[model samples]
Target: MPEFDDLRDEPFEPEVLSSEIAFAGAVWDVRDDRVRYGDGEIRRQYVAHTGAVAILALDADGRVLLIQQYRHPIRHRDWELPAGLLDVAGEEPVEAARRELAEEADLVAAHWEPLVSSWTTPGGNDEAIHVFLATGISTAPAAHAREDEEADIRVEWVPLDAAVRAVLDGRMRNGILSIGVLAAAQRLRDRG
Candidate 1:
């Protein structure tokens, strides 16, 4: 075996010969691009997104807040963190997390710490998610009106350990939820 340097993702921007919006959807757009590689040109199409934020709201009892919403693409009401797109122009990521927590869970958090960030699906989309560990939790003063899929969201608070188990047991499959729960669990262990 040979020793190696630090393993990390490097930024490489190949020359784009041509780029176009193949489809324009209500929330996101699909982009088709022709890029010049080292020896040849390659064409790729992916979803161009505005990114998003998620919150892992932990209460004093060591439980994490989760929401169940219907995902048309997956055709399942998956359990997930309180999350929302960064579609609001000029809104900061943490602020988006705060707003999402209130809108989805009807909760507000006083203390927040950045837990982790991840690219949802690098091979097919440019959507990145920033997850925060929100503590000092309380009910929001005003409730937000829901619509469509969000109108019937099921909110639950489960123990942090139980959430980790669900992720490991293949019960909870949301990408953001898995990342946030694992990161928060590790952070808590490291703190103790």
Candidate 2:
């Protein structure tokens, strides 16, 4: 049997980092996650949520599509698959996945398969990034993005072996996107 990471009920100890959204004037609370590990002391943890999406797009020729975007937080451009946060209050996780797909790729997938769900930075944020397999895509104009955002996202098709090679070669930067793409590619190869 394949082994999976097991989580158990633990404790939370928090220290407030921020109490406001500085730009939007919305009240927001940010805290540090502390878990009991050794000798019942506190260990810093990542707080994650179930509201993020990682879309794996496979085109008509079975080529995997990837995006290159400038992430200011990291100070440079990184090659990654399409992904975004599912921040809408009343929408399901998959709903955010579809919306992100349309906005980022400007394409709609006729078929979608939920592949994997994971946390991006477990030592800080508790964000769960739901990865999906998207096929049978058609292109259109982008639907949405942040007003001040200028994501010069380059969409290009990469062969399966080449994509995986890039990941192994340290070219793929996003952790979750790398795992999502490799997993989806493996499944596709198995099916073929």
Candidate 3:
């Protein structure tokens, strides 16, 4: 094991001079903030989001669950993991992941492990997604009705190796899905 001091995290917190809502939308809010950086304060505009959760659902055969959904911003359909927003008041991130898995894929996972977490767009958005590796999966009693984008999504199970290759080949455009798949692959390899 490495030394404790070497593994310690250095805390660095910046001071926010001021912040205000530049625009408010139904899904997200745009905020303009002035913060102290280095020796001066700079103003930046970014999206304030409620965060999200994603699940990399796997079966006994090791295939991974992927969803094909239409993203209006990109004007195309892209493959992604089962995901949902943390908009429900007082709901935990993991609970959101479970809810998304049931809602989008109609599956329930008996084993769930934290895989990875990342900021979807750190430079422009404060949206962070926490992804989990869910195995020992089975069909749920009743899948929840989807709304909006989720209403038209198609779910499928793909081989882990093939999914990883798709992510490396730029076919998998969703950042959360890519990161989660890669991390899950690495963890699987390490276990073997």
Candidate 4:
């Protein structure tokens, strides 16, 4: 007999009854899963989410621009690159990137590189995130931020080697940043 985690012999099938926004400011959904793992079993699941986007702003000094913000879920300040949601209606991805760069870091760039695209968490809701590299940057002014954000916005000019090391050391937790850094390095190496 194969070991099964089902201690309770509950016999049931999953059926999505109704997915309704019991509250505001969230994507609410109810889903059902009919398991066919050598047997007929089912389960119901509910999920809700708010999607977002992330932008990687690269400068001429071979350093990546990042933002230090307090993430409520983690309950600590995280050093992540500038990012925002594709929340604007009828806005292109590039436009969303530019807006996020200006809004979060007050920086602008002359060159835009199509780096990569990702779904933050595809297993649940439809939350997709787009990543880009903005090179040849210059200083500007931040237009938007939360009113109560305990933010100390400092732009760290980290070299590629240092960035990779940060990832190894567990300092850089943002997956997009690591991906961006590796891509930038490859781009540089290819130029040689």
Candidate 5:
């Protein structure tokens, strides 16, 4: 009998028979791969992502920073945490989170601690996102220029509990936002 005391994801890599790009986009690409599995072979396709980072910026008053941006796929301008892709070569995830916080919210944080890491859609994509808890926040020295959907981003600060409520009520639908807020809230409870 195997012990069931600990539950965690185990990494496994199967033998790849063939792999190729099924679709190439500006940011991500769809990868088609044939792998040997259980005495047989299977073909699968998924988005090959560069990964991303999200920051849950919390102020002294317990308010969380959020930004509303237009997401074309969903066709809704949904509220989301400060997040961006890890597209820059040689840049660390924490640095990417810091840059995103500054760029999206025009803010800087004195303290940053990792909250959680998740795979957005393990079945459809290989996108892994790292969420960080940012406290001791202040305005950035300079604001970054925005373009496209980010040009009209709306920034707001909501109480941490209220943000969690929004997530539970389905008013907030961004996966990263939902995960970050809930994880931050749980972290607070654990600390208290």
Candidate 6:
């Protein structure tokens, strides 16, 4: 049996007693919160994220779609997988992933599978990101109009081998992108 099978059992979850907005930002909000831990109460400041999704879109030739977009916080453009926030009201994570794929790459997939779920920075934020693997790709019927920083994004398709190299060589440093590409590659390898 896999180690993950043990994780199926429910675990104790800390209950938040009170929370207040410390700072509200365009992308994420900071909150000052108090929670009941195992046997004690604690107060901490953390980011209350809206969560997000990332897509590892693989074409017929095993090339993965990547995007170079300006990240204002880091003050640099990064090569990353197609992704977006789950900020839309009543939208599912997979739905957000599909929307982001269309909006970012203008591509659609006939097949979709869950790849990984992770907390981008659990120590300081509640930002959880779910990644997906999308294959059997084609152009979307209608491309979404980009705005703000999204308008300046550049899209490219790089072979999987090259992407792995980039990840191994520290060139692809985006957390989500690095996680998605490596997991997708490992999944493909495991399938063979």
Displacement of the residue 41 alpha carbon in candidate 5, Å: 1.3
Model 6 C-alpha lDDT per residue in residues 1-192, reported as the tens digit of each score: 456655653556699999999999987889999999988999999999899999999999999999999998899899999998999999998889999999998999999999999889987998999999999999999988999989989999999889989999998899999999899999999999
Q: What is the Cα-based lDDT of residue 108 in candidate 2?
A: 87
lDDT of 2 at 51: 53
How close to the true structure is residue 19 of candidate 1, measured as C-alpha lDDT?
94
* Prediction 3 global C-alpha lDDT: 0.91
**Which runs of model 2 end up more than 4 angstroms from their true locations?**
1-29, 33-50, 141-151
For candidate 5, write residues 20-86 as lDDT tens digits.
9999999999999999999999999999999999999999999999999899999999999999999
* Candidate with better lDDT, 1 vs 3: 1
Better model by TM-score: candidate 2 vs candidate 6: 6
What lDDT tens digits, residue by residue, belong to model 2 across residues 1-192?
866577554666455433332233232234443444545646343333445888888888878878777888898777787887777888887778788888887778888989888767765666778899989888855555644333567778887678888888887767976897789877977989
Worst-scoring 10-residue span by lDDT in model 1: 1-10
The C-alpha TM-scores of every prediction are: 0.96, 0.76, 0.92, 0.72, 0.96, 0.90
Over 4 Å off, model 1: 1-6
What lDDT is obtained when candidate 5 is compared to the true structure?
0.96
For candidate 1, write residues 153-186 as lDDT tens digits: 9999999999999999999999899999999999
Model 6 scores a C-alpha lDDT of 0.92
Look at candidate 6 and tell me the lDDT of residue 29: 87
The residue pairs in collision within model 4 are: none
lDDT scores of the candidates, listed in order: 0.96, 0.73, 0.91, 0.68, 0.96, 0.92
Give all candidate RMSDs, comma-separated.
Answer: 1.6, 4.7, 2.4, 8.5, 1.7, 2.3
* Number of colliding residue pairs in model 3: 0
Better of 1 and 4 by TM-score: 1
